[model samples]
Target: MDYLQYAFFRNAVIGILIISVAAAMIGTYIITRRMVSITGGITHACFGGLGLGYYLGISPVFMAAVFAVTSSMGVEWIASRYRIREDSAIAVIWSLGMALGILFVFLTPGYVPELNGFLFGNILTIGTSDLWAFAAYTVVLVTFFALFRRTIIACAFDSDFAQVSGLPVRFINYAMTVLVAVCIVLTIRLVGIMLLLSMVTVPVLIAETWSRRFISIMLAAIVISIVSSLGGLLVATIIDVPCSAIIVLLQVALYFVARIGKDISLKRPIR
Candidate 1:
C-alpha cells in the first residue's frame, strides 16, 4: 500500500504495538489491585502538565510525567498518612491538575496548537521519536514485570499477606505507582486523556470473561489489544475516521462477544 511508504504509518503501527503491550501489563495490575480510578485520576492530572509545558515552552511529555508521578504519590500519601479515602484524594488531585492546566494554558500568550491532539489524540501524527520513547519505556516495563512477577502478583492480590510475608509492600506500591504514571503519560498521545482509560481497561475486561489466571489474562489482553488496535488502525486508514475511538469500540465489541461466549458456555451440559 502507498501508505506503508510513509514514515508516519510505520510509526503509528510501532507505537500502537508498544503501547498495547505496556497497557495490557499495567491494566492487569490496575484491575487486580482496583486502581482503575487512580489511573484515571493520574490521566486527568497529566493535562495540567500539558498546559504547564505549553506555558513554559518545554516538552509536554516531561511535564506530564512529572504531574502524573506527583498525582499518584500525592494520592498515596493523602490516603495513608492523613487517613483520607483514596477516592477523595483522587478527586482532589484530578480537579487540581485540570484547573492548573487550564490556568497555565490561558496564561500563555498564543492560541495553543497541538493541544487538541493531546486531548483527543491523533495516532496518524505519531513519529519515530514517539516510537523510540515508547520503546524505551516498554523495555523498562517488561523488565520490571519479568523480574517481579511473583512479588507483584502477591502485592496485587493481597498486600497485607505480602507485607506479612516480608515483601517490601510499600516499596512495590511506590514503584508500580511510578510505572503506572509513566504509562499514562506515554499512552496520552495514543488515545489522548479522554479515551486513554479504556485503552487500559477494556481489553482486560474482555479477557476476564474466559480466564481467571493472572498471567493468562495479561497475555490474552495483550493479544486482544494488539488485534483490535491494529485492526482499528487499518480500518481508520481505509475509512478516514478517528483511529482511537474506533479502536476502543472494537475492543468493547469484543468484550460483548466474549461475554456472550461465557454465557453460552455456562448453559452447556457437562460431558
Candidate 2:
C-alpha cells in the first residue's frame, strides 16, 4: 500500500490498464483474422527501429513504431501485389529487421544502458507520455470498432465475402495492418518484444474458451488482461522479480487454468 505513494508505480498501473484494454481489443481482431504470426513479425521488426533510434540518439519507441508499421505494410503489399507467399514475406521481413537491429546495436557507440529495458521491459519505467499514448490509442481503437464493427467482422471472418459484398476489404486490411503494428509498438513497453506476442494472445486464448462470439471474447479478454497484468505487477513488486516476465508467466498460468476449466465444463453432464 505504501508503494502506491510512488509516482512511478501509479504510472505503471495506469499504463498497464490502458494498454491491456487496447491490446485486448486489437488482439481480438488479430486473432480473428489469423494474423498472429504477422503480429509477431511486426514486433520483431520494431527492434530494428529501436536499435536505429539508439544509434541515432532519438526516441526508440518512435523509431520502433516506424519500423513496425513499415514492416507490416511491406508484408501486406508484397503478399498482395507480388508473387511471394505471405508467410515468406513475413519471414524475410522478420529476419531482415532482426539482422538490422543487431547490426545497428553492434555499430552503436557507448554502453547503451536502455537496451535491456527494450528487450525485457521494466514496467516501473513507464512514463506520463506512455500513458497519454496508450489513452489516445484506446480512444482511437474504440471509435474505430464502434464505427465499423460489422465491416471489420465481415473482413475478419471472410475477406473474399467481404470484398464481394463491397465492404472495402482492401482498405480495412491495410488499416488493420497498420493498427496492429502500432499496437505492438505500444505494448513493447509493457512486455518487451520477447514476451509481447504472449501478452497479446494469452488473454484472447482464455477468452475464447469462455465465448465464441467476437465481442464477448474481446470483453472477456480485456477483463482477463487487466487482472493478470495488475496481479503480476503487484506480485513482482512484492517478490522483487522482473515485472514483464511475471506478467507473461501469470497469463500463461491463467491460460492453463482456463483450458482445464473448459475441459471440465465440456465433460460435465447438462442439467
Alpha carbon lDDT of each predicted model: 0.94, 0.92
lDDT of 2 by residue, 167-234 (tens): 99999899888889999998988888999999999999999988999999999999999999999999
Q: After superposition, how far is residue 43 of candidate 1 from its true place, in Å?
A: 0.3
Error of 2 at 109 (Å): 0.8
Which regions of candidate 1 deviate over 4 angstroms? Answer: none
Q: Note the residue pairs that clash in candidate 2.
A: none
TM-score of 1: 0.97
Ten contiguous residues minimizing lDDT sum, candidate 2: 79-88
- CA RMSD of all predictions: 1.0, 1.0
